[model samples]
Target chain A: SQKIEQNSEALNIQEGKTATLTCNYTNYSPAYLQWYRQDPGRGPVFLLLIRENEKEKRKERLKVTFDTTLKQSLFHITASQPADSATYLCALDILMDTGRRALTFGSGTRLQVQP
Target chain B: EPEVTQTPSHQVTQMGQEVILRCVPISNHLYFYWYRQILGQKVEFLVSFYNNEISEKSEIFDDQFSVERPDGSNFTLKIRSTKLEDSAMYFCASRYSPQSSYNEQFFGPGTRLTVL
Candidate 1:
């Protein structure tokens, strides 16, 4: 069975500091790894996706790095603010037999940006 | 930006009763999906629909579950008979054709189903 694990259950950091979250998986080599932001009681919003062949990807203040050899991904949110406080999820894209893609998610890491 | 929309933000049904969850996906999106998350648990994929047919389904999507695109816009998931374990937040998601962009999916505000 495939297993995905986020680094911690929750993280608290000060505003303007960088918050780094980790996601590790075992028993699978996914084609693409994605990150999503989920506020309490809301659906997850897509943040970024990095292909297995790509080492790192950036969008604004967010950066994601994929290390296939290590079966790990690191998600960084720099210049974090109180509004950035939310649960960050890591998901792997799975190709189904019918050629459609589905997502398998990890138990997300919740980040709380304190003032 | 067009986003997926789900009806009945919250639903409560008695055990053994049937419930239908409805979603209107983004107009131009071609792929549709259903996922559920129990309180404090990871979101789990239930099924994927494309071309008005089921493309893939997870083990949790057993005989009790069925999905249909009843019309051009509305996609539905029906639970034949709800069980206690059916309590969870159900989300509807859609994506544009893989050819156009990163197959990123847009999710709707979920429907919280409480089976008592």
Candidate 2:
């Protein structure tokens, strides 16, 4: 079985600082990885994705780096704001026989930005 | 931008009762999905629908659970008999072909199901 472990600790950082979240996986290597942001009582919103071949991907204030050899990925939110406080999740693309269209998600790390 | 919309942001039902959560995905997207998240747990995939049929489903999507796209605009998940463990937030998502975009998914507001 595959398991993705993300830091369960709530991170508290000052606004404008860089926030780095880590995701580590065990078992099969994934073809692709994704990051999403979720607020309380809300669905996750897609952030960025990096393929096994890609080292890094970026979108505005967010950046994602994947190291397949290490079986880990890092999600960074730079110039963070109070509004950026939310749980960040990492998911790996899975192919379960039914044909590859689903993702296996991690527990997610909660972030708290203080202004 | 077109968005996926779900009905009854919150629903409460008794155990063993049938519940149908409805969603209207973005008009032009070719893929649709259903995912559930138990409070404080990781989001789990339920099923995926495309071309008016089930493309993939998870173990959690047992016989008691079913999905249907009755019309051109509506996508639905029906739970034959709601269980107390069925309490969770159900989300509807849509996406265009991987060739068209970065495989990004657009999610709905989610319907919170509370089984008593």
Candidate 3:
């Protein structure tokens, strides 16, 4: 069975500091990996997506690195702020037999930025 | 910006009752998906729809669950007989086009369903 795991523990950091989250997977080959920010009781918002061929991707203050060999991805938030406090989820794109793509999400890691 | 939208922010119903969650995805999106997240759990994919048919569905999407694109813009998920375990936040997502090598899905606010 395929499994996606992230740091179950919440990460607390001071504002302006960099927050790094990890996502690891096993027994699955995905074409791409994406990161999303989810607030309590709200839906996930897209962040960054890195394809299997790409080593890293960045969007403004956010950066994501994908290592297919290691079966892992790292998400980094630079100059984090209190508003950045939320659960960060990592999703992998799984191609279905019918040529459709669906997302498989990890348990997610919660980050808290203290001011 | 156009975004996916779901109706009925929250719903409460008794077990074995029928429930229909509605969503209107981005008009130009070609793929639509339904996912559920239980309290404090990871988001689980239920089913994916495209070309007016189901492309893939997870084991969680049993016979009791069905999806329909009744019209061009409306998509719905129906649970014929909801169970207590069915309580969760259901989300609707859309992808602009699968033809793109990398298309990120846009998610809606989600509908919180509580079965008592």
Candidate 4:
């Protein structure tokens, strides 16, 4: 079975500091890896998606690095603010032999930015 | 900016009762999906609908569960007999295309279902 793990259940960091979260997976070679932000009582919002060949992707204050060889991906939120506090999830896109695609999500890492 | 929308922000139903969750995906999106998240658990995929048929479904979506896109704009998930374990947040998502470069799924606010 394919498994995706976001190791840290929760992380607390001071405002303006960089918060790095980790995602690791096994038993599958995904075509794309994605990150999403989910607030309590709300659905997840799409953040970024990096292809297998892409090493790193950046959008504003967020940066995500994918290392296929290590079967790990790192999510970084730089100069974080209190508003950036939320549960961040990493998902891998699996393309089945039937030509269908599905996203398998990690347990997610909750980040709390303290002021 | 377009977004997926779900009805009834919260639903409370008795065990063994039937419940229908409705969603209106982004107008132009071709791919629709249903996902559920139990309290403190990861989001789990239920089913994916495309071209007016089920493209894929997870094991959790058992015989008691069914999906329908009765109308062009409305997608629905129905649970024939809700169980206590069915209590969770149901989310609807849509994507414009399946192409890797344009496949970011946009999720709805989600409907909290409480089965007692």
- Write candidate 1's Cα lDDT for A1-115 as tens digits: 7799998899999999999999999987789999999999999999999999999999999999999999999999999999999999999997766676679999999999999
Colliding residue pairs in candidate 3? none
Model 3 alpha-carbon drift over 4 Å, by segment: A96-100, B98-100
lDDT of 1 by residue, B1-116 (tens): 78899988999999999999999999999999999999999999999898889989998999999999989999999999999999999999998866656678899999999999
TM-score for each model? 0.97, 0.96, 0.97, 0.97
Which candidate model has the greater lDDT, 1 or 3?
Answer: 1
How many clashes in candidate 3?
A: 0
Off by over 4 Å in 2: B98-102
DockQ of each: 0.80, 0.83, 0.83, 0.84
lDDT of 4 by residue, B1-116 (tens): 88899998999999999999999999999999999999999999989998999999888999999999999899999999999999999999998985545579999999999999
Candidate lDDT (C-alpha), each: 0.95, 0.92, 0.94, 0.94
Least well predicted 10-residue stretch by lDDT in candidate 1 chain B: B95-104
Extract clashing residue pairs from model 1.
none
For all predictions, the C-alpha RMSD in Å is 1.3, 1.3, 1.2, 1.2
Q: Which pairs clash in model 2?
A: none
Clashes per candidate, residues 3 or more apart or on different chains = 0, 0, 0, 0
lDDT of 4 by residue, A21-102 (tens): 9999999899899999999999999999999999999999999999999999999999999999999999999876677789
